[model samples]
Target: MGESRERLWTRDFVLLTVCNLLLFLTVQMQTPTFPAYVKEAYQANDFVVSLVISLFSLAAVIARVFTGEALKTKSSKILAIVALGFVAIFSAGYYWAGSIVFFLLLRILVGIGFGMGSTTFPTIVSNVIPAKRIGEGMGYFGLSTSLAMALGPLIGLGLLNWFGFGSMLIVLVLLVAIIFPLMHFIRAYNQLPVSSGNAQTVTGIRRFYDKKLLLPAGLNFCLSITYGGILSFLALYGKEAHIENVGWFFLANALAMVLIRPFSGKLYDRKGHIAVLPPGAIFVGISLLLLSLTTTESLLLVSAAFYGLGYGMIQPSIQAWMVKVVTPEQRGMANGLFFNSIDLGIAVGSVLLGVIATHSSYSVMYRWSAACLLLFLIVYFLSQLAAAKAKKAAVASENVGV
Candidate 1:
């Protein structure tokens, strides 16, 4: 009976995880394919092609601000459904978008729909998973997004190459439409409002940005910068390094993530972020160093596994930390900021590392990218120091009063 309550694979949890997976698949499938489609179909230059990617992400990041607030109340059932349906509608509209302007507008609308749905799904999951198993539950759920990230682009590009852009849109619409039916049967959204406490008092913009989220979000941001570099430049790096079938890196990385996530989560559950973060950061930094000099496909995949293992450890730990620190009602906001940091970091990393690559080599760029994690380590340790100092001071104050 005790084990039953501790269960992480309840029906609704699985349903919500699937729903999250499909929605993210819908988004990520577009990530790599859209830039190509826009350049070819519209004969767009670099700036316009860039907009095809950035605007959707920027809009999605912005949209989460409002959607996160709405989710602070009753769970995001209605918001998510409406937003997802809105996404499907806009997605289908892509077939008829006459100009690049029209297509970009459609992308923003879809991004909003995506933003709303993304925030709601995690908030619902946070509410549903057993308190003791939040780390494990979120780790399992995080796999959906990670897997989609790994698979969606491959699938999207295949659909684009084998079929065409229009067919891909149709498939995407149908995929999202399936989520609507699934939502009806899902009963996992049990988030009650933060009825009392400081949560009730905070209003307007302040309510949306919780200070407690800053350190975790910042660390997540730093980690994402390296990922952004990978997403934006790994293929180019493959070219530079003269490695054939560089795609194997992602394959190995995905495999490593699947293997490592559960153990990382369990470690985090038992020993907190300290157990997970330091070693995870070391693995990632070492992975980047290895990738910098990777000359063979075998070495490339080995580097990927290290990266996957480190990332699998850190990301869920940060997310679970954010969820644990917040009140139940604030989970949506926490999740929103969590995702937004990733997007923002990715954007920044691409631009920052691109400049470095322009001046130096891809190998050098990767070296600099590893330095982001060094910053991650420095910031993490400093925060720990500050927290310890605060705790010591509080203890001394109590002793003095006694």
Candidate 2:
């Protein structure tokens, strides 16, 4: 067990990670780029543009709510492939969308596919990795996502600048399509044998969702809400701040994530969530506060570094913790709940902040985001304290032969 845990790298693991990276690259590229495209193409206002973007998250939340139950009937790879097909089809439809209304509908289709595919990839990867080293392995796997976040929008904007919106859409479509062949290269693990105890549990909606994941997922939702603000407005804010390019903020954030994820994951596996999450949350809050005050390029990049470190450390640790608490059969549900909450957060944040920014300013908007993170920190510690007490009571009852 010890030896297997340390042997983190394997062929399937590499392939799955690469597959996830490619998928995320396509998703990330669309995030910032699409909103700009919608605004320019349709002369839409910030509220309208934000609604179009947040619509994807809303669709994703709806899709993920049922995706866990769907996984129970199908293999993760099978579900992922079908979902990828959804992304591929809608990506091309972007070229034909003549109006914002039509484009919003297409975005919903893409979101459904994306939510299902993203959830399954993590579920499959978690099962392939050594159980003891799950945190460490997920850390490495998450780099694919972090790197995509760094470069996807940059790539999207570059394509738009060099070619046009149609060409950019083609590139995104191609990226989603590339995963089809790559999926064949991956050798997925066999299904784990379900114990009778698990098999006998009542089948219902509750069975399809993991309640154990709520605390970490809720905390993740808080952080991602702030992330939604960055996604929705950083480019506009950069222009407002007189910075030449604001995309570099994501580049800086991704770099910091790349630097810190491995170490943070190892720390979680060794010392548990207490060793990582609280500090990570604080870092994210500070980053948001700094971003609120960004008057210089250097300060902007510094804020990115803080955001990267905080998100990179906290996100994977939450995922690792989600997987840790559930049985193998329940991983699908846990992952679905985890990602659904994240998308919901981003969706709510985008719409709510759009209203706030309209009424106030982007700077004020980010300060509110920072406040949300600080609130998350307090909530997280309280949850942790409750969990510790519950755990202690469980041990005591076990000693009493419950």
Taking all chains together, each candidate's TM-score versus the true structure is 0.97, 0.91
Supply the TM-score for candidate 2: 0.91
Which residue runs of candidate 1 sit more than 4 Å off their true CA positions? 1-4, 190-199
lDDT of 2 at 172: 87
Q: Which parts of model 2 have CA positions greater than 4 angstroms off?
A: 1-6, 40-48, 98-100, 189-199, 354-360, 393-402
List the pairs of residues colliding in candidate 2.
none
RMSD of 2: 2.6
Residue 117, candidate 1: Cα error in Å is 0.8
**What is the C-alpha lDDT profile of model 2 across 1-402, one tens digit per residue?**
768645779877888888889888998888868888888899999788877767887788778767776766677777887899999998899898988899999999999998888888888888788877888999999999888887887898899889998898888888887788888877764545244473556476677666777788888888889888987788788877788878779889999999999999999999998899988988999999999899898999999999999998999999899988877777877888888777778777877887899999899999999998778888988887987999999999999995
Backbone clash count for every predicted candidate, in the order shown: 0, 0
Question: Worst 10-residue stretch by lDDT in candidate 1?
Answer: 190-199
Q: 1-402 in candidate 1: lDDT tens per residue?
A: 988879889888999999999999998889989998989899999999999888999888988888888887644788888889878999999999999999999999998898888888888888888888888889999999888888888899999999999899998998898898888888765545444455466787788888999999999999999999998999999999999888888878888888888898888888899999999999999999999999999899989999999999999999999999988777888999999999999999999999999999999999999999899999999999999999999999999999
lDDT values, one for every candidate: 0.90, 0.85
